[model samples]
Target: MRTATPPPPPAALTVPEVMTALRLSRSKVYDLLRTNQLKSFTAGCARRIPTEALRQYIDNQMGEAA
Candidate 1:
């Protein structure tokens, strides 16, 4: 019998990670953070945005654009 497979890892994205995902500049990402549209959370000493949140934001923006 085959055993169940493990689930994939949840993507934990840093500021630079998110920027790389979207091909955005560091300043542009920080601009979104400053504008109050995009939100970020700090874990310990590091700031990270949930990949789901970023994906949702992108989907919403795409929906609006279309």
Candidate 2:
């Protein structure tokens, strides 16, 4: 009998987590948030970035490179 595997977690990523994943500095990440380039929302004192937004940002950058 084979059981089904559970799905992965949601796309919520913290500031430091996103910074590490994007290889960007904390200031740069914050600047993105401030400039509305990166989508994010507040969770009390913490902020979270969706994985989709990161993907979109990457796609936009790639498009601009061409």
Candidate 3:
């Protein structure tokens, strides 16, 4: 029998998804977006955050902590 490959992660994440992942409030997530700390873009009036940008933000936070 052949094994099936796992599905890939989303290329972008919703604000609520980010909030849950980062343990942040809705306002805090928007604040990060407004401050440009967390990069995001709009898709037909819906905002989405790229997975890579989220990773970069985490990396930056780690660097700052060190």
Which candidate leads in TM-score?
3
| lDDT on C-alpha atoms for all candidate structures | 0.83, 0.91, 0.98
lDDT of 3 by residue, 33-66 (tens): 9999999999999999999999999999999999
The better candidate by TM-score, 2 or 3, is 3
Off by over 4 Å in 3: none
**Model 2 Cα lDDT, one tens digit per residue, 1-66:** 999999896678899988998899999999999999999998998999998888888898899999
> Model 3's lDDT to the true fold?
0.98
Candidate 3 local lDDT, residue 16: 93
Candidate closer to the true structure by lDDT (higher is better), 1 or 3: 3
Best-to-worst ranking by lDDT: 3, 2, 1
Q: Please, what is the TM-score per model? A: 0.76, 0.84, 0.95
RMSD of each: 2.5, 1.8, 0.7
**Models ranked on TM-score:** 3, 2, 1
lDDT (Cα, 0-100) at 53 in candidate 2: 87
